[model samples]
Target: MTTRWALLSVWDKTGLVEFARGLVELGWKLLSTGGTARVLEEAGLPVTHVQEVTGFPEILDGRVKTLHPRIHAGILARRTPEHLKQLEELGIGTIDLVAVNLYPFRETVARPGVTTEEAIDTIDIGGPAMVRAAAKNHEYVTVIVNPSRYSQVLAQLRERGEVDLFTRRMLAAEAFAHTAAYDAAIALYWQREIYGREHLPSFFFLVGEKIQDLRYGENPHQRAAFYRLPGMGSGTLAGSLKLQGKELSYNNLMDLDAAWNLVREFHDPAVAIIKHTNPCGVALGETPAIAYCKALQADPVSAFGGIVGCNRPVDKEMAQEMVKIFLEAVIAPFFTPEALEVLKAKPQVRLVAAGEGQGEGLSWQVRPVSGGFLVQEPDVYDFAEQELKVVTQRKPTEEELKDLLFAWKVVKHVKSNAIVVAKDGVTLGVGAGQMNRVGAARIALEQAKEKARGAILASDAFFPFADTVEEAAKAGITAIIQPGGSIRDEESIACANKYGLAMVFTGVRHFRH
Candidate 1:
């Protein structure tokens, strides 16, 4: 019987000793390098160092350990007679399997204040070369890069005495993907280092690990899965910890993200009720319970089955109030033990803990178009007091200014042509994704009804005409806030003055389409 040779080299030594032992038990010679060999030897398994096969000592601080022609030829040579004869003439043995994983380049760079030299040292050259060579010769050599596949590969070898061609091909594909993502991480890190985070690179590589496979996409027929970006911090929805309830769906994730982002805008105890990626109602109060009550009161009908987000921890008081309604999900920084017990009354509701603090690291907002993607900076800009210009003759009162700022924050998260009517730090009505600005205003005004009187209105963009202003004035709106860039902005200002209403221009447009 011919002696089967398997080469193993990996930075992550997970399952390495046991895997090498399995190969040794299966009558296979183990060839490894440096740390991997040390681990196998300590496990009392017979293993040959790569340097012994290459007949050359490892040099360059172990960077050139597995780059020799002996290692490459052994793994890449075919099983054909001609290839075997060439290997025989070169005194080289054919390696039937190669298991290699690259260095921790991503993790190293993700560390706070990581130096360039530290990051550069972590770039694995010989490892990727070995993995790719073995993957390319998958017809002859089986390649494994992921440690999770060790058990399955060992099982296959134990049962059949060899890995099948189909399994080898799949392993090769995975090995290539592993190397690709590794390279992408290195490329992105260097790009960001050389040209600042604001500079857009010619080639953008997005690498993600599959977090879960959803039951369905937005609809039942469509397929979908959730992927977490590499090195993502715990502040995002992807990093949220699920405390209870059924698995999150695609739509649930979407709505949860919207609710979380909206609620994060306020410093006070805030709550946002979201439906279909739009805020049905939002408010800030002394406590999360009060905020939830006010936000729910804004639109009780729309709040039904909606997702809820809170900036502060969910306490027993808040949980008690939340359980009174039918909420699909509630996400907060944390949940008290008493609160969890109270929330247990509604076991179906999803409880997620999105960790506190600002979203760590920079991220681009990405949207898919027909052929490619639209990448832009997130709308994290908040208007300063200096940016506010009272265009109308009447300046907003102190109370109206506070509500206008609150309404402005809420409108920024709404879809384009958005309108929000808010009073006393609570959104009374929201009109989003309308075709016309006046149409959106009318919808919001209609929703507010009597509550619209003395409430402040916020528009996501400049009014194209005076129609929205006239509509707001008729609704007894006391103040209006919008970006003032339209050619007909003066007309809207004149109408505000005529109605004795205060209108402020933020000098910024937040279109959330």
Candidate 2:
């Protein structure tokens, strides 16, 4: 009998028949259950029905298919003397390779109005057991979980007609990750279904499959990889289908995400120019043409090499104007024929279209630490006018209030302890990623240059000290909008009064940290 017993089961039946044929050619008996067996039998491949070996039919609507001892013993049995003797005595065949992938619970649950019964039906109990069995027996059995690993496994099998210890170890690691991510999706959905929310995992872990290895990380020396949860929504990458350009770097993804978010905030024809993950300029106009011009005029120097996003389609005139300046990325819902042609001429421009993206509304964000990831809800909300309190005696002018609201929206997405100064639908200046609020205020004032005078200021958080207010006063800032939560709110209010700056407390705070 062949020692290589290949157990195959998969929801995504990509390359399964071919892989099974290859295994059979190499003298490995294909052992499978359910749809896997049917697929192979239909394809006329030699497959041993798992029930013939286990002596039991699938029960509980296929939930108890591969959870038997006959299957696991073959996978989990040690290669040591006593284990080998016991396996031989029990007629337990040594299962060598397991090709398994779980059901698509994420998709089932994500569907509109999907009942809990339907979602539960899609969760496979047997799949996780098989995967974990193979992973636990990495010392003796080879496991293949992701189809992405098919080529490498095929290469190893073709080159030597067998999987090596090193390859088996890596495959086992991937198998665990596959099942973990599968379980996580189920856990999140289950909690959301029953408890109305998925609480933080006490001992949380996620296994993201590598989508693409980027050219470099934040810098050229460091390496980076784009990872994705199998069934979860793909972020900017899913929506952004790159037309033509060099591959995106780590920093490029950052800037593009920021650009996409800010531009999406407005429904009107709008343009948002982002540099280093912060909006340098944003404007809403009658058309994409007008929006681009207004955004460009906001701060032309800073807009250089920035990522530009628009809510409306890009037209030929807008594209022609765009060619006049250098940019890293241009993203829009659509682009007119002439506009695409114009941008096509500029091959270096990374153009992306969002019209064919995954869904109507999607929110996903990822953060990386030295060792792992930190993923959570995106900072998304609307600030109602009723939430505002007039901290200063004087009420803001209608125009000033509109500009204040604009500046306030821009300030939230900026880095922590950040401050933004804007007026009349234009960004006067932005100070982001600063340690202290006062320092950020000072930087914005300096960057604004002559434009600082009379521009409204918006802070992501309340001013801890009165110095920032004092600085804005010296810069001739006319109005301020911020969330008032500082312990020294009275002192800050006094300083705003002293400087004659029309300040308001927008009870809703937006800290990007």
Predicted model with the maximum TM-score? 1
TM-score of each: 0.98, 0.88
Give the TM-score (vs. native) of candidate 2: 0.88
Expressed as tens digits, the lDDT of each residue in 42-125 for candidate 2 is 999988989999999988778787888899888888888898889899988888888999888877887889998899899878
Tell me the spans in candidate 1 whose CA falls farther than 4 Å from its real position: none
Candidate 1 vs. true structure, TM-score: 0.98
What local lDDT does model 2 show for residue 102? Answer: 83
Question: In candidate 1, where is summed lDDT lowest over 10 consecutive residues?
Answer: 356-365
lDDT of each: 0.93, 0.82
Each prediction's number of clashing residue pairs: 0, 0
Q: Give the C-alpha miss distance for residue 394 in model 1, angstroms.
A: 1.2
Model 1, residue 369: C-alpha shift (Å): 1.4
Q: After TM-score superposition, what is the CA distance of residue 143 in candidate 1 from its true location, in Å?
A: 1.5
Clashing pairs in model 1, backbone N/Cα/C closer than 3 A: none
lDDT of 1 by residue, 385-459 (tens): 878999989999999999999999999999989999999999998999999988999999999999999999999
